[model samples]
Target: MSQLTTHILDTSAGIPAPGIAVTLFVLQEKEWLQLAAGITNSDGRVNNLWEEGSSLPHGLYKLHFDTQEYFERNFTASFFPFVEIAFYINSHAHYHVPLLLSPFAYSTYRGS
Candidate 1:
């Protein structure tokens, strides 16, 4: 498992948000460097954003969820074009960031 991971749950639809694009970035100097990107599977999880057992340096990181395309594909109007969550990783601990989403709203939190 990568040190970092994420999943999306479409609360409005009461199911996993499959096929959503998730991107990972690391802050280098003053730029956000693209680290990895993947589309969610049927379970809404991207488990291969990085090589299994890979460790990342402690720094600022961000996850971008492409919400607009997801909503468009399902023919649902959404409020936000996309969702960006910036977080800090201070150790090699596994980080699970999950998103709870709806058409007009979304929420995220640090997960186990």
Candidate 2:
């Protein structure tokens, strides 16, 4: 079993992306269900999406980041209103999903 966590970096600004809304979802059958939600802290990290130290069951998961609001607040133009990264969890290691974001582009990967 493993728990989920995430962070966002504004690649264009070279800083942590603060205050962005992030949500975690699990795919069940054909529907996606929200499991946890949180806004990024000043450090752009959300480590406690669920209970700390508790493990999530193995399944397909998604991380949704609200980029539109972040860019709007910063008075910057953006191409993506939001971003979603979906991946599989089938191991016993902790999951760290990180987002590298810019106004017109973004990327994500399994992190440490």
Off by over 4 Å in 1: none
lDDT of 2 at 59: 92
Number of the top-ranking candidate, with lDDT as the measure = 1
Candidate 2 local lDDT, 51-101, one digit each (tens): 776777899989999899999999999999999999998976788999999
Q: To one decimal, what is the Cα RMSD in angstroms of model 2 from the true structure?
A: 1.6
Per-residue lDDT tens digits for candidate 1, residues 16-78, read 999999999999999999999999999999988877877988999999999999999999999
User: Model 2's lDDT to the true fold?
Assistant: 0.91
Q: In model 2, where is the ten-residue run with the lowest total lDDT?
A: 1-10
lDDT of each: 0.93, 0.91
Q: Which residue window of length 10 is worst by lDDT in model 1?
A: 47-56
Which candidate gets the maximum TM-score versus the true structure?
1
TM-score of each: 0.97, 0.95
Clashing pairs in 2: none
Clashing pairs in 1: none
